[model samples]
Target: MIREFFKHLPASVDPQTRDLAEQQLVGYACTRRPDDFAPLVAHLDSILSPDGDYDEDEDEDGKPKPKKRRDAFFYL
Candidate 1:
């Protein structure tokens, strides 16, 4: 697993294995997924800083609300 690779990467005794883990980490880090980010953007508003953004469903001012911007997220 990636966590195992990461654990060994920092202090592995074998040079070849360490090099392999480094290469694998790079490959995983660069990969991207395709999906809209409204859900995450909304959620991150809480995760990044609690007492988050405006209510998505409410429109007290009578103007249409803007959509949340999409962003990348890694499973690791």
Candidate 2:
């Protein structure tokens, strides 16, 4: 099932990122049960989404503030 999820990842994702994601997924699968799949998928979806919550304030050069990476293992 986790393999299926990795297969479905976006093609635009770079090889390095995809490989890292696969490793992360495999680690998650090892530590979790079958029933945890739904939440795992949802978590992956959130990270993969291009749209993210950002502050209205701009950086010194006027670009939008970058979003910070959240801890993926928070839910656990």
lDDT top scorer: 2
Q: Give TM per candidate.
A: 0.28, 0.54
Each candidate's lDDT (Cα)? Answer: 0.42, 0.64
After superposing candidate 1 on the true structure, give the runs of residues whose Cα lies further than 4 Å from its correct spot.
1-12, 32-76
Q: What is the C-alpha RMSD of each candidate to the true structure, in Å?
A: 15.5, 8.9
lDDT of 2 at 20: 81
Candidate 1 displacement at residue 71 in angstroms:
26
Which pairs clash (backbone N, Cα, C closer than 3 Å) in model 1?
none
| Runs of candidate 2 exceeding 4 Å displacement | 49-76
Candidate 2's TM-score: 0.54
- lDDT score, residue 58, model 1? 43
How far residue 37's Cα lies from its native spot in candidate 2, in Å, is 3.2
